[model samples]
Target: MYYVIRYGPAEDNSADLYMDPIPGKKVSFTRGERLGTLPLLTFRKRAGDRGAFLDYLGSSPPCMVVSDRFVEALRSVGVDNVDFYPAQLVDEATGKATPGYQAANVVGLIACVDAAKSVYTLMPGLPEGGAIPKNGIFEFKSMHLDYTKVHGAKIFRLFETTSTIIVHESVRDAIEKAGLRGIRLIPAEGLDAFY
Candidate 1:
């Protein structure tokens, strides 16, 4: 079984902080591409934001900026498919720097979604060819995967939808056991109304 990763709900009395790649900086964390010699990426807290920085910081386009503990936990579980690049998060309002975070890019792509069993609509002008849509947008209602095509990969982005990240059951167990904050796992079979 696999799961869809998401940010956990915010705690009461805590304001959520959204981080963005500082304007004018180049971002190379493309969907599932393996990066080499990444530029030092810097993120800034959105204006008017003041709050505690969770272990996982949220970003537009869904890049993973995680804490050292989060990195260690994944490493402890022998997950080698992910690459981490050094990153910094600064609050402009107070000039405070939140350290110990890195941009995590999960590598590899597996086009394994079971389109016949899933609910989705292809963008206009595209043919209903096979299980995978060719370079077209798929607005998914619910998603299911073909476990056979996964090839035992612990973590990967779907080729049909690179924006979506899937993790194996063992990976989810490691994260939960480590008590990592700011993360939520939705069963792959239960994905609906999701990005």
Candidate 2:
């Protein structure tokens, strides 16, 4: 079974942090593209707050920044579809840099969602009265994948929704076993309920 990974609930009175690519740094992690070189990024921590660092940090435009522990756990489970790039989480308030984090890019695209079984709405056409494009982009109400097309992929960004990250059951097990923080694995079949 596949799972949708999302950030866990925030701690009370703690800062909610989000990563952002530094100005002029090109980022393509969300599109499943390889970065020839590392990009400069920073985590903007909310002001006047106390929060512990988390194993997973989410970014704008929907990218992932994971702790080294997360990377190691996935590797231990033989997950190879993801590439990691070195990144530092610089505190916006103190300008302090925290290491042991990496920008995770789930490589490859898989158009594996079973549209007939999934609940979604098509995006409007670019021009008025123009033909609606049946591409990956859509407003998903509930997504069900064609597992046959997944081919045992442990982790990937769905071609039907590039911003969504899907992981295999084994991967979720490994993450849970490792006691990783800041992540929640939702069963793909139960996604509709959450929405």
TM-score top scorer: 1
Per-residue accuracy of model 1 over 20-131 as CA lDDT, tens digit each: 5445555544467777666566667765875556676666546788888889888877889899988777787878777788989988778887877888777777777665
- Highest-scoring model, lDDT: 2
lDDT scores of the candidates, listed in order: 0.74, 0.75
| Regions of model 1 farther than 4 Å from truth | 12-26, 134-137
**Candidate 1 weakest lDDT stretch, 10 residues:** 12-21
Looking at model 2, report the run of 10 residues with the lowest lDDT sum: 126-135
TM-score of 1: 0.86
- Give me candidate 2's TM-score against the actual structure: 0.84
